[model samples]
Target: MGREDFERMARAGFIERNGTVVGDYDPRLLELLRAMDLAADLPELWDLFDLMKAVPLLVVRGEHSRLFSRETVATMKARHAAMEAVEVGGQGHAPFLETAGLPEKILEFAQRFASSVRAEAPSS
Candidate 1:
């Protein structure tokens, strides 16, 4: 967005500054922006409630991360009943990169989730 447009949106309460919200030069920023622009407050998925009801969700958190709070996790669970939250041990924002064994932990979580998904499927 142009500076003028962004400024106007900010003034109108449609957008606000997200100061250093993510790690510096986080490549995920662009992927996230492409998926959904937080500044616009746009709804990427129209039937979010419906989808939430149909799917299981896992929310992993860094123990010391400031990006999301306990309240946010609670709200997320309230919104989607099938949500699971995991906290990485002894780390802060971007713990998966900062802490040792993080990759293993994440991979284990993924494997378990996948196994559960397959188990839940109806047998042909």
Candidate 2:
């Protein structure tokens, strides 16, 4: 499923023009390996979901990403009622890698979350 989507994106000129660099061959191998490494080498880091209880949580989603299902987002929102989810336009699973302007959206979300945190705190 993932491969098919990636192939489609490549054909649509989403990747590099040079075969290895972009729309040529299997480019998603690198991202897949990185995710695998994170899951395998830092299994404990996955538990950060619980640690989010002590900090502000912002959930960023790419509008087209199959990686995050609506049910998962709902569960996260239920877990952290204060959490905010923002979806970026014209993007898929790895928006940062696949689309432009996603970084700007991420920055904007961070800024908004920070301001909200400061606004809600009691005065010293």
| TM per prediction | 0.47, 0.48
How does candidate 2 fare on TM-score? 0.48
**What lDDT tens digits, residue by residue, belong to model 2 across residues 1-124?**
3676667666666555445554444777778777675545445433567668767777767777899876778888777777777776656675553345556766887898789899999999
| Model 1 misplaced stretches (Cα beyond 4 Å) | 1-50, 97-108, 120-124
For residue 105, what is the lDDT in candidate 2? 61
Q: Which ten residues in a row have the lowest lDDT in candidate 1?
A: 15-24
Per-residue alpha-carbon lDDT of candidate 1 for residues 1-124, written as tens digits (9 for 90 to 100): 3576455444543422385333334466678668875677656552565467666667777777798677877877787887777777655554444245656766777898799999989999
For candidate 1, what is the TM-score? 0.47
In lDDT terms, how accurate is model 1?
A: 0.65
Off by over 4 Å in 2: 1-47, 97-105, 112-124
